[model samples]
Structure formats: structure tokens, C-alpha cells
Target: MSDSPDDSGALHLKHVLAAAGVTDLTDVFAIRHTAKNDGLPDLWTASPEAVLAYTREQDSRFRVFPENPPRSWLVFMDDGSHEGAHRSRFYGAYENDGEALSERTELNRSFHIKASPLLAAMKNRLVVEWTAPRRWHRRGTLAGDFRVLEIADPQVIPFVGYDKVRLTYQRLKAIVDDPHYSRWHSALSAVKGIYLISDTSNGKQYVGKADGGGGILGRWSAYAHNGHGWNKELAALPKGQCEHFIFSILRVFGPEAIQRQVDEAEGHFKEALLTRGKFGYNAN
Candidate 1:
């Protein structure tokens, strides 16, 4: 029942039930015997609303058991036959724990009647309810045409104050230079975007788009060494204080679109760093 449905059969049943105005079993089963006599599935499906309406009518006297775990319920017939209806209540239909049921066999046997037809009707309704797809559901947006903007703010946090930044850069360089580092470099190339490491503190600014060679992590490994200007800046941060942020652009763009986007983002990153003020503008 938890599986997504490929068709609309489940929805059709809900619509039919709503139209019948029969919400409980009393009114639902009270219909002419001829209507009830039809095949159980057919009868229930034919007017589900009526059945639901009828069940609601009996809400006052129906006794549900296992108050804590909510195992089952007993619906008594007005005829006072002592044999009440025993319906299983499960959080989910697919969870079948026979061991628990066997333990409670005595209680079940005493309260439950062999009303297969009624049980089948109830099961059918539950199936419909469980299987129906949620209406008006929206899927999350996929990352597609992503762009990396450059950081233009010259006055923003400079990669100079922290000692950890320099150490992280050294570690990164060592990681990328080793033969084993090729795989890591390849992985970073696939990342959609990379944040320029501005300061060891709260100074993340999206700066550039990575060429589809790998992911952000991979790219970091690649640049960890090489003593580039950015690497030197990162190396200056306090040990263990430097951080890199990478964003993926799977949903937003084709190659050309992402390139332009990244360019613009880098520009914004620069502007933000210069204007934001916390990035060590006065130190140097």
C-alpha cells in the first residue's frame, strides 16, 4: 500500500465513496439486502461513502482494544448476539507480525468472530486509503542550471589572519600531489560550484563553477598543494580553521548556462566580501 500507484484506479474508488454520503456501517450495510448481497468487494467499492458513513454511526458503542498499541477493535451487533465484530487495526498493512498475534490468540479468539465478509470489506477500504496517491504533491526542484559567481569584494575577509588556514592548505596540497590523489581530484571536478575560501571564520562566498571533471571535495584535494595564491591565503588561517563550501548544480543548467552563472556568482562573492566588513579588511 505504501508503493506509489502507476494508475488512477485507487483514486476512482475514493471519488465514488465521497458521492454516496454513506460514512458509516449502519447506514452502509442498512441498505437493501440486495445491495449488501452483491460480492463483498463490489458492494464495498460500489458505495464506499455509505459504508464509511455507517461505521461512523456505530462510533458510540464500538469498543476498540489494545489502547496503548492499538491492535484491534470489536464492533457489537445491535442484536446482542455476544459475538461482536473483531477488526484488526494496524499502523500499516504491510507489517505482519504473527508472533504478537499468536501471543494474544486467547483474547483474539474470544472477541473475534469469523466474519470474513465484513473483514474483507474493511480491508478493501483500508487498501484504497493507503494506496491512494497524495493529491497536488510537488517534487523538490532538481539542481540543473547552476552558476558560480566570483567574489569581487576586495575588502572582505582576507585569507591572512588564521594560522590553521595555512596548515589546511598544506594538507590539501599533500593530498593532491600523491598518486592516490588522482581519484579524489577527479571526483571534485564533477562538483557544480565551489565557494572561495575567504577567511577562516564566517567568510564563505560562492566564487566559481567547477568544470565537470569532479566534485568539490575532489577539486579541494587537487588544489590542496601547488601553493597557488588562494592556497597561500587559505594556509594563513589558524590550523584546522579553514573551510570550503561546494554547491552542486544538477538541476539548474547545461554547460554554457552554468558557466555564465558561476561567473556572475563569483562577482557577487567579491562584492559581498568587500561590503560585509568582518573579513579582516583593516588587518592588512
Candidate 2:
């Protein structure tokens, strides 16, 4: 093992990999996977199997590399710790077979990757600031200059609390569907709440209620499945438009809370946010 952190207390990515016996930096590449509205689950909260599946199925359509694709891959999960500077947690390393596939192919190119143990111990423990914030993927030779933000303890992003709840549509779906997010499911299912959905594309807001027996989880599950939970205005959105919607809670009620009180809370938010106005998405 080598000293991962340097004199300036900054650990360079190249130095870390070099310490891990990755002698051939030219054959390697790095990818920073971020949460998106794209039907894919958030890798940060996804199961280990799901993570591996995503890493192996490097779809050729997105055009990550036009030529000179590397054989070894360094996967990282986009840690949304900052807005401008791109910080990512090292996921793992994988070495693929030496089969070159055409980048123009639209089909999914499944790489036969044998999990590399080179950086196994450092997974999730290593944080690096990606130099190219705009580019999701880059050649390893070019990415070696990334500054290691930390090599601290493994990060555990918990389902902190209901008051702090905020999620994109993609993350909402993951919490509902993925078994890995059962803690989130338990918390959300225990409360009835007035939720807000904001369409980031047009800056429109929708205040909705989740007073069902299944609580907020049940209400949002519908939106997770269909992008719109049968709401008149939400259903009218153009295809894929609802992906821009973000979900958050405004108020919560216990299971025994009166139905009328929940209704009043929902009405209160609608009036305050002016969701029924032209700038909003609420139809009523």
C-alpha cells in the first residue's frame, strides 16, 4: 500500500491508481454516473448487482468515445455534494475483454468485465473532483489529474428525515421500486402528506395530496409508474416531460389524522404556491 494522500493533503487520482498497481494508465477510462430522469435508477442508492449490471452494459449509442476506447474502466457515482465542482465517489474497477465494438451501433454493448480487485478496498471510500465537470466520461490518461477530495470513511447517505425529503422523479421511482431503498419506503409509507411537484423545465409547480391508506408512498408510486398519477394537468404533459418533475413534502400527518385536515393542508399549499395559476401545472 502507498500513501494515498500527499503533502498538501490532496490525493491525486493518478497517484491512487498508481498505488493500486494500475501501471498502464492509457488502457483505462473513467465515468461519472449522475442521477437523471432517464428511467435508470440512481446508482448511489441502487443494489450492488444493479451497479455491476450498469457498469457492464455500456450502451454504445451515447457516444462516450469516438475512438481509442479503453479496456479498463473506473466507475464513479456522482456525489451531489456541490453544484459547480463535480465530486464523485469511486465505485469500482472492471477489466473488459479485448473485443472492439463499433461505437456507431445503437444496441447495448455488454462488456465481459472481470471485476478488478486493484481498487476494491477503496470503493466508496475514495472521493475525487472530476476535472471535466461537463463531460460524464473521459479517457483515463486525461482524467488522472483529478484531485482526490478525500479518502475518508465509507459514505452512508441515509434517509435522513421527512422534513429534509427532496427527490427527482428518477430517485422517487428508485425509492419506491428498488429493494435497496426499503428504509425510505418505510419512512414514506408511515405518513400522509401534502407533496409538491415542480417541473424544472418550465418552472411550474403542482401541489398534490397523499392521504391514501398506503400514505405518500402509494400516491407517488402511481407517478413513478406512469409519470403522472392520473391528474388532469399532469397527464396532459407531453411524453417524457414529467421526468423533469421533482417531488418534495410540504406537510405530514399521522395515520389517524382527519381527512379534512389533510385536505386543508393541500389546499393551503395550492393557494400559497399558486399552482392553479398560469405559471403552475395544477388544473383545479
Best by TM-score: 2
lDDT of each: 0.30, 0.78
Give stretches of model 2 more than 4 Å off.
1-9, 59-63, 66-68, 81-84, 100-108, 155-284
Alpha-carbon lDDT of model 1: 0.30
lDDT of 1 by residue, 212-272 (tens): 5444454454445333325444445555553342222222223355576766765565565
lDDT of 2 by residue, 64-154 (tens): 5433458888988877666566778888887877433553246666666767786888887788888767888878777787888878554
Clash totals, every prediction = 73, 0
Candidate 2, residue 198: lDDT: 88
lDDT of 2: 0.78
Backbone clash tally (model 1): 73
